[model samples]
Target: TQLLEQSPQFLSIQEGENLTVYCNSSSVFSSLQWYRQEPGEGPVLLVTVVTGGEVKKLKRLTFQFGDARKDSSLHITAAQPGDTGLYLCAGYTGANSKLTFGKGITLSVRP
Candidate 1:
């Protein structure tokens, strides 16, 4: 089984600040996904990067896949209070495999 680790497991920032969270694994992944978890609900998929060195943007959030495809990062610009939540990263080997999840970073953005 592959393991994913996220750094700076907790983050607290003021509104409108820019921040970046990382997810890493020694094992190479075929693809990686970013998700945001809300209170009393499961994570919601935000984006998936299949190709190495690919970057995807969703509003103020940017997702990137490392060149080796063993790591990923989520960067948020001008973060708002609404962005405060638990962010998760999941790696996929293939269609038949299970999702390898990181412990996730809990963000607290004070307005």
Candidate 2:
């Protein structure tokens, strides 16, 4: 079984500020994915990092997988009010593996 631990359960930041959220676990994973979700909606996948030490960028957001495949980080640059939402990290072990999600991080960006 895979378990993910996330830090900063809640974050309140002013617009244009920068922030970073982390997901970590002692178990190794085949891939890790990041997601964003808004109220009354399902989570939307932001990016998936498959290789250890791989990094992916989506606009002002950057996602990185640790070299050991046991951790990941999501950094947001110049946060905006529209970016306010819940962020989640999920890890997958294999094709038949169930995805394990961390306790979500709720971000509130103030204008």
Candidate 3:
């Protein structure tokens, strides 16, 4: 099984909609980060929660880390086309320091 998996690899919605993408794993992590990347740009860090049960919110986006530190979630409220992009979740552990990325969720919000 994959180390990390995300649901709904693709999402399409009208302007002013709401949606959520989930990241799940069987292995625990020291910390997990959420990132949003636009075409031709690097993935920008949206949120990073290290403690279990931690939650962070940025404008219309909400982030949550599972109590077991094995999963995370991102929820968007009143999503606009401007909010459209590639949503990715990454987990970090050990000396590798390499992030395990989700298959990627492509969100397209149309007006």
Candidate 4:
């Protein structure tokens, strides 16, 4: 099985729409980080939930960690055109700081 997978590789919606991106894996990770990246610039860390069942919110974005640290989700509320970018979830093995990333979900929010 793939190390990590993401659902709905691509999504396009109008402004004010709601959407959820999923990341899944069979292996457990020490910590997982969620990032939102735009063209050119590197990804910016959105949040990192280390504890199981942990939930974090940043503005209109909501992030949750699975009870087993094998999965995670990102939900966007009333998404706007500015929300359009690449959403990536990365799992760390706790050594060398190397990260395994999901396929990624590309979102396009039209105004």
Candidate 5:
């Protein structure tokens, strides 16, 4: 079984601050994805990292995949109250493989 671990399960910050969250696993994944969820809504895909050492950026958010494909991280710059939400990391092995998710991190940005 594949399991993902996320660090700093909860975070609170003032608007305009920066934060980083992490996800790790012992198993290798074919692809890794990050998502953000708002209250009463399903998670929205943020970015997907496939190649090792690959990095993707969306506005103030950045995503990276580990060189060994066993970990990932998300960094947010100058966070805003609108950035408050649940962040999740999910891994995919293949088409027939079951998807595994890390214990999500909840972020609150107080204005």
Candidate 6:
């Protein structure tokens, strides 16, 4: 079983600041996904990177997949207090396409 691990399990930052969080694994993935979860709800898909070295931008957020497809990063620019939530990184692997996920990073953007 492949495992994806997220770094800096919790991050707290001020509004307007920029920060980047990471997800990495020793195994390769067919595709990588980023999800944002709010209180009392399931995680919502933010983006998916299928190819190596691919980058996608969503509003003030940027997502990148490492060339090896074993790592990914999520960067937020000009973060706002409203953006505080749990961000999860997941990947599809093996023939079964099992969804492997990390513990997630909780971001708090203090106003």
> Using TM-score as the measure, which candidate wins?
6
lDDT minimum window of 10 residues, candidate 6:
92-101
| Candidate achieving higher lDDT, 1 or 6 | 6
Per-candidate clashes, comma-separated: 0, 0, 0, 0, 0, 0
Q: Which sections of candidate 6 miss by over 4 Å?
A: none
Ranking by lDDT: 6, 2, 1, 5, 4, 3
**Tens digit of lDDT per residue, candidate 6, span 17-86?**
9999999999999999999999999999999999999999999999999999999999999999989999
lDDT of 2 by residue, 14-82 (tens): 999999999999988899999999999999999999999999999999999999999999999999999
Model 5 lDDT, residue 95, Cα: 75
Q: Tens digit of lDDT per residue, candidate 5, span 1-111?
A: 429898889999999999999999998889999999898998899998999999999999999999999999999999999999999999997675677888799999999
lDDT of each: 0.93, 0.94, 0.91, 0.91, 0.92, 0.94
TM-score for each predicted model, relative to the true structure: 0.95, 0.95, 0.93, 0.94, 0.94, 0.96
Clashing pairs in 4: none
Clash count, candidate 6: 0
Please write out the lDDT profile of model 1 over residues 1-111, one tens digit for every residue. 438999779999999999999999998999999999989999999999999999999999999999999999999999999999999999987565888899999999999
Those runs of model 4 whose alpha carbons end farther than 4 Å from true positions after fitting are: 94-96
Relative to the unseen true structure, what is the C-alpha lDDT of residue 51 in candidate 2, on a scale of 0 to 100?
94
**Which should have the higher TM-score, number 2 or number 3?**
2
Error of 2 at 31 (Å): 0.3
Model 3, range 1-111, lDDT digits (tens) per residue?
678898789999999988889999998999999888999999998899999999899999999999999999999999998999999889997657898887778999999
Alpha-carbon runs more than 4 Å astray in model 2 = none
Q: In candidate 6, how many Å is residue 85 off?
A: 0.4
**Candidate 2, residue 45: CA error in Å?**
0.4
lDDT of 3 at 32: 95
Name the better of 2 and 5 by lDDT. 2
Candidate 2 residue pairs in backbone clash: none
| Most accurate candidate by lDDT | 6
